[model samples]
Target: MKKLLSMLCALLTAIGLPGCDYVNVKELQPGVSTAVEVRQRFGPPQHEWRNEEGSVTWEYSRQPEGAECYMITIGRDQVLQSIEQVINEQTFARVERGMTPEQVRRMLGRPASSQYFQLKQETVWEWLMERGSTLNDPTYFTVSFNPEGRVVGTGRYTKLRP
Candidate 1:
């Protein structure tokens, strides 16, 4: 019985129970919706900034287990202009939600510009360049999916190379 208890404890710790609690509106892609629409969806973001000229910028972020993070940015017009999701090698290895983690890893490695799929969830994966960040960082591609197992969108953001 003691051995079983120890095993259970170890499993719980490894699984990262109470994982990520992330939900935001700016995650919505740009060129699709306006700022007023975004404000209505997420109900005033956690953080907002405005320039002297009245341009607006909103930022949303979630830190998943293993210190991984997902961030999205929206411009003044309420357009989703940027997104950043980072899963270090370790966090990448621990993803067991939504389609086997190995499958997710494979998709990330061999990206073909665009891939769409629908399963227990829908996912559209793509590669693009992100705004901000110097040329030192490698380009990052994002695979975004919708709830009902349908991939509604995909995008990529590459950092400029200096």
Candidate 2:
């Protein structure tokens, strides 16, 4: 009986306790915060879709070039209605913050307009890209969010002159 109890406890501990400490984005809840809170904690979303009803679909890039970490659906009221955070490449890309201008240009190619501005007293840069382009061959971009999760700027790049 003692041996059996010990084994069960060990198994339970192994299964319930995580071996490492990491902030998992999967556990975020919407009603817990406003849209601004979500942005502040997770940084800028890789992409967002806003509906006529004012609901927003936020796609958080899992990697700089791979899957999406989390897909959160928020209503116009600013509450979390649904959340899906499974590892799938179709949802989002893994992107990192604090990239230099040259590095961004190299990764995303040349921009149609590279603008620099000050917002809330912070310096931001935007590189607008053309549409129908891939990460391997990107073309369209209305705006790029900083790791801080703000629309710092916008730009675009195309084979033909605009």
The model with the greatest lDDT is 2
TM-score of 1: 0.27
Superposed by TM-score, candidate 1 places the C-alpha of residue 8 at a distance from the truth, in angstroms, of 32
Give candidate 1 misplaced runs (Cα > 4 Å). Answer: 1-27, 51-54, 63-71, 86-162
TM-score of each: 0.27, 0.35
TM-score of 2: 0.35
- Cα RMSDs of all predictions? 19.3, 14.5
Pick by TM-score: which candidate is best? 2
Question: Candidate 2, which segments miss by more than 4 Å at Cα?
Answer: 1-27, 64-67, 86-162
Q: For residues 1-162, could you state the per-residue lDDT of candidate 2 as single tens digits?
A: 755644444453234321110233333465765665455445556567676788886765333222224556678888776666433222113223544554443233333343334464443432322122344443434345554645445434444433
- At residue 7, candidate 1 shows an lDDT of 46
Over 1-162, each residue of candidate 1 has an lDDT whose tens digit, in order, gives: 755644454354344331312323223456776665445433444445454655555533222112223333566555666544534444334333455323553323323244445563555544332323444544454555565543333334654565
* Residue 65 of model 1, lDDT score: 17
